[model samples]
Target: MRIISKIKTPGALKSSTSNLLGRFRHDDDGAMSYVAVTGALIMMVFGGIGIDMIHAELKRNKVQNTLDRAVLAAANMDNTMDPEFVVQEYFRAMNMSDALSGVSVDQSLNYKRVTADGNATMPSNFMSLLGVDTLQASGSATAEHGLTKIEISLVLDVSGSMGGNKIVQLRDAAKGFVDLMLPADGSDMVSISVIPYNATVNLGDTVSQYFTLDDVHDYSSCATFETNDFTSTAVDPSTELGRLGHFDPYNSSTSGGEIAKPWCATGQTSAVIAHSSDADVLKAHIDTLNAGGNTAIDLGMKWGAALLDPAARPAVQALSVAGFVAPEHSSRPAAYADSETLKFVVVMTDGQNTTQYDLKPEFKFGMSEVWVDTRGTNTLNDDRFAFRVQDNAGDDSDVYYWLGNSGQGYAMKYQNRPESSAISNGVEPYQMTNAELYSRFSIAAVASEFYYPAYVDGFLTYDDYANAYYGYQATVNGSQADTNLSTVCDSARDNGVVVYAIGVEAPQAGLDAMQDCASSVAHYFDVSGDDLNDTFSSIARSLQMLRLTQ
Candidate 1:
């Protein structure tokens, strides 16, 4: 498209031609079109890069979170979860399988460490056109365990109901737990106190000195915990709170036999085994646990928490000095504020609460019943008296009057009788009725009237009349004991003690009570068919996790 024809002067023609050529070569008319296309391309590239960057960031965050969780799970002290599999599983669960890689675990005698690293390639958009196919994102995490000092009180229910296979299962499970918590070389910082409780807690003879020592049943190895013990979470043996007594079943046979069984039937005054790091010792003590006596869970729980309380430190020290408790654990009952120290109480029970009986301090040394009879004569009736006594005195007399009718009453009408040394005289008979004299004197005076009846009616002691005098108080049963057990459990929980309650073949009420006593709903277990081994193992695993987290 050229219409060519130009004529000008020689000088003007050269300048014009040069100007035309320069304009044709440097013209900006089409430059705007090319710039617009280039600008659009640049915008696309930047937008694609921004999008890819955001995608990479999101993928990296997801990978990091997943890896962290996987490592923690793999690092669980008691779990056998594989590190690589756990990491890959988590990634798959999150639908980020491409990011899973480099998973590893390092386990030691007392520690576990898990590490995981993962990478993902984020797809690029317009950047791919420039040879940028994808952006790589990576994440890594490591979880490790620290040495945690744990003090556990295994409060087992050695009640009559936990007999036979249940006890065996408990032993095996408990020994397994001990193995889990205690190091094989016995060099770890874990201590366990095995407390087998029933109607009462056996503190033994030496341990008795640590307590206030209720001398009523001083000869026994067990102690009946009072309501105050339940009210107070810590059982400070240094305080004059609880009393030492024989484990006397509420309604046990009193058929003129040997002394009542130790309240908890702890074989031959088996004193409580204080805190120990020796797993064998703990297992041995657990094996010695026998099932007998009524259920006094409160006592068991109270002592369990007590041994973990700092208030019992002095007692622990004393016991350690006396070689009763191990020297290393003498400083036990570490302060509650110790963050690195963990305290646990595994309370196992098989029955509901039962009646608990305790003996009074003083011997039951009085006559139970006294009666006066009027005999012979008309004007003045001669009064003869009868007396029955059951002596629980220290004179080696535990026998009650086993005579025909001498086993009936707790106390006689009079308390102090006239001295047997006093001369017996056939004096005068008062005009008072027989019942009148019977109602007026102390048990002792009634004894005098019976042995020296001449003073009242010029009559002799009757050889025929006899009656029984039951000395002990009536047995407490049902709701009373249940309330006691519940009260103690509440106290234990209130004191910030972590209680893991296990109910084995127990009544509904017992299961409910155990569930309520637990630190949380998840902390309770009910094994009706006697699968206590699994329950204990689960608890041990949970405890191991806790230790790892610490």
Candidate 2:
């Protein structure tokens, strides 16, 4: 262990240092160690940058989710709070109030839209080494809750079956629905037409003025629709509608009074209230509904769809001018292609289609063969016999005789023509027109007092008498009514009209028809007891159309 220190000259020292440096550079013993050190430094820098990116992404996701929920809550039409305040509260509850950048809200009486922008900043951990101090996360979202315009046709069944407690419940439910649709604040964006249908739809005087109807009688304002009318959704004002005759076939008493329960419902309250947003007016009309006729679901559905169609715009404008409809809705019932407007029909029925009565073509209007001997009183009673002029086919001679109380034959005979001769005392016979005859007597009364006697007298067969003047003919049967309902419903669906069908304790046939007519299975409601109000509320909620636009 002798440690000896040796010193060399400057030139020798330089040569030795150069030889040692060359050896150090060329040696392979410690090469792997040097590479491991450099690799570790580079991995550390990249791993820190990845961590910073992950933190920024997490913050961005939090901001995006919060903004989305905030905007949606703020856009809700039912939310009465200020939209900006709502959004701030949403972010504050999530402990991210500092991340909210700003909020924007656009609103109207019927619609509300909200947009929210938010951002968050995450301090960089290792990325700062590459000149980055912090990472930024930002997002924006928008949501809207409303339909620009809504047109609803509420077709209600006021048939005989809907009488009693059922009608009372309907009135309450319908009035509640009206209150929901036409808010007290009053938005002109929505208009509702209440069509109450039984055997026929009563047009009322105001609504009937727009249509050209046959001059049969002015007792009631109801039209007889052809089967082809159900194939389309427009009730053309230019088309002439046949007026339903005012005659009661159910009552046969020869009493001198008005015919009870004519085929058409004849009253101001039974008439349709079209394109109105006044809750008071609509509710008042609902209050006066008296049920007495058979069901006509097809007619109700047709009228509901027709009123929503743009083809009825002219009539709506006329109604608006007449002060029946709100002036603001004169341009409503917007075109089917109008994206901003929504058309909906809520058809509710409690029974299936029954027999619909209509007069025969020959009996609808004109002079009749029978003459009334008024006895100078001008009143039609049992004492005032109706004289019939029967023809002898062999000689073509007219034989006039007064109809007797019995259904077999005449009570008396007139030698000369009855119109010219004094039938009783000094009272002359008066030729009765068809209108006068129907107005004076019921169909049953005429058939029993005149036609039945003719059949018994062998002048006419039983079948001919029954077909001629007995009860009214069934112009529309049940099967045909179902077909018509389906046709109109299909037309409505094809035209982009949303149909909501409800069967309130209805029969199987009625339920089936309503289900088939609905826009979807969910749109059809088979409600009973106390379910009507809930079903209507569900429908109202669905109509809100709330969604996020961004």
Q: What is the clash count for each candidate, in the order shown? A: 24, 0
Q: Show pairs that collide, candidate 2.
A: none
459-487 per-residue lDDT for model 1 (tens digits): 33343111111112323465766666677
lDDT of 2 at 223: 85
Tell me each candidate's TM-score: 0.63, 0.82
lDDT of each: 0.64, 0.82
Stretches > 4 Å off in candidate 1:
1-53, 73-108, 114-140, 145-147, 247-271, 322-328, 360-470, 474-477, 546-550
**Candidate 2's residue-wise lDDT over 129-220, tens digit each?**
99999899999999988755889999999998988888887887788788788778886778899999998888887788877688878878
- Each prediction's RMSD to truth: 12.0, 5.3
Candidate 2 runs further than 4 Å off:
1-61, 107-111, 123-136, 144-147, 372-385, 391-397, 401-436, 469-471
> Which candidate wins on TM-score?
2
